[model samples]
Target: MKASYSEFVELGGQRYHVRRWGNPQAPTLFMLHGWMDISATFQFVVDALAREWNIIAPDWPGFGLSAWSPGGYSLLQYTTDLDRLLDHYSPHAAVPIVAHSMGANISNIYISARPQRVSHFVNIEGYAPVPEFFEGSLGQVVGRWLDHIAKPGQGRPYADYARLCERLQQSNKRLPPERAKFLASQLGVMGDDGLVHIAADPLTRFFAPISLHREQLIELWRGMSLPVLCIRGGRSFISKAFEHRQEDLQERIAALPQGREALLEDGTHNLHHEHPEQVAQLIEALLEQ
Candidate 1:
């Protein structure tokens, strides 16, 4: 795969590894993966969609093969960088945006706030405001205190590459052994401690003090006029405390100015990876709209 891939490109002094698949004349679809995930997350879907749209996927800094920023990395920085990439590449406009998890959040902000730069959007299992999701339940809060007393950020890392593979397989119960193996391989790196540490930066695993306000995201949605296809996993949280009800969201989505939605029958937070066939169908439908 790397043999067929283009070399990493440097932009703004940081290297970003990007890969494009499919026809040059076709419409472009920019894929964004969730936090801690690499561009490999879209390998299967990108291959399938490549025959139609030019699919471009880049590894977010600090997560995949891309170079991380000097200090802590933040989503705001990603949005600014994304805007530059869009200005440079999608200047002609009408670029379709497809994203999952944190990627979904970034794309949502970009398209909603700057519709002139984007054509359409497909968000899968995007995060929404929860009064308690970030705050935590009283019981969970107590549990956290207990956890802190026991050990602070001391969970054991993977024992070995094989163990890492096993852990990924177990967590992603929907994945086949081969698929899990492929994903696990991308995230494993030799660490100084002689272990295959997961590619995720530990600093990013915890919540940062700064983030866009929930109300602000809602405002973006309200002002958004571009076509939107918001798909949520039926099993996913509408809030950290509530699951999205598909039958209910159908009407709610229809009521939104220019939005439509579907609930994936077999999907998780990583809906695109977990249910690529359904997600691809949604993307095709959105493109037609």
Candidate 2:
């Protein structure tokens, strides 16, 4: 039987757009997506898995259908908000979590900090500077300015829905063409200023780059004490500056507690969207472990 999409409780006054599957009363599986990505990215994969496990996927607070937090949002904000989300929706019952990119980072911290609360952990392309960037005041100010400058050009504003979809497809080449266009429709609103984007407040791009204190988070990952499955999109843009140094990411992964790594053969950084069936297959294996 197919499940339906619905909105659940709002967080910090922001509405959380969520989609569910299977029996709400059944054992659950939680899916969290990457930055600028909506829960719909998991639609195909979750649809295939939902019959047996209740599945819940929500847009991150500042992105997707969820209302953006006032004055933009940050990593810490997402972490705190997600804690509330899990608490209200699945409190007292540990559920398996599958997350990609930013979702992976936050899930690692949350599950690690409170190990018993999570039944399993699946991190897809979630490696942050495994050792983390330095965090003195200089790093903060410099990082902030560099973040904005890195984009170089003001991002294009979609003149229409079709244009928006094209831009999205360009952002992540891994998405199936038709599906990419479909998702683009939900990501913006028609406005006099062109298709004023609806997802991720414009200023959100300025949020501080997180510098995880490795010693702290490594200890946290250890506490989570659960089997972790790490999947990397074979074509992940892990090395933005030097494509040749893609393997450099390993030093960081080696720093991870310990686990076998899997590669999604036909994927980019957003591997889940590119190869949902493979991601689902990998998760099934992790669940069994």
lDDT winner among the candidates? 2
Q: Candidate 1 — which residues are off by over 4 angstroms?
A: 1-4, 136-156, 244-255
**Top TM-score hit:** 1
Scored against the true structure, residue 89 in model 2 reaches a CA lDDT of: 85
After superposition on all CA atoms, what RMSD does each candidate show versus the true structure? 4.4, 4.0
Query: Pairing residues by index, what is the TM-score of model 1?
Result: 0.83
> Candidate 1 on 119-197: residue-level lDDT in tens?
7888876655433455666566556545544443523578677888898878778887877777778778777888788
Local accuracy of candidate 2 as per-residue lDDT tens digits, 80-149: 8778788878888888899988888888777766677788888898876443233457666667657664
Residue 213, candidate 2: how far off, in angstroms?
A: 3.8
Q: Weakest 10 consecutive residues, lDDT, candidate 2?
A: 238-247
- Measured by C-alpha RMSD in angstroms, how accurate is candidate 1? 4.4
For model 1, the local distance difference test gives 0.69
True lDDT of residue 212, candidate 2:
68
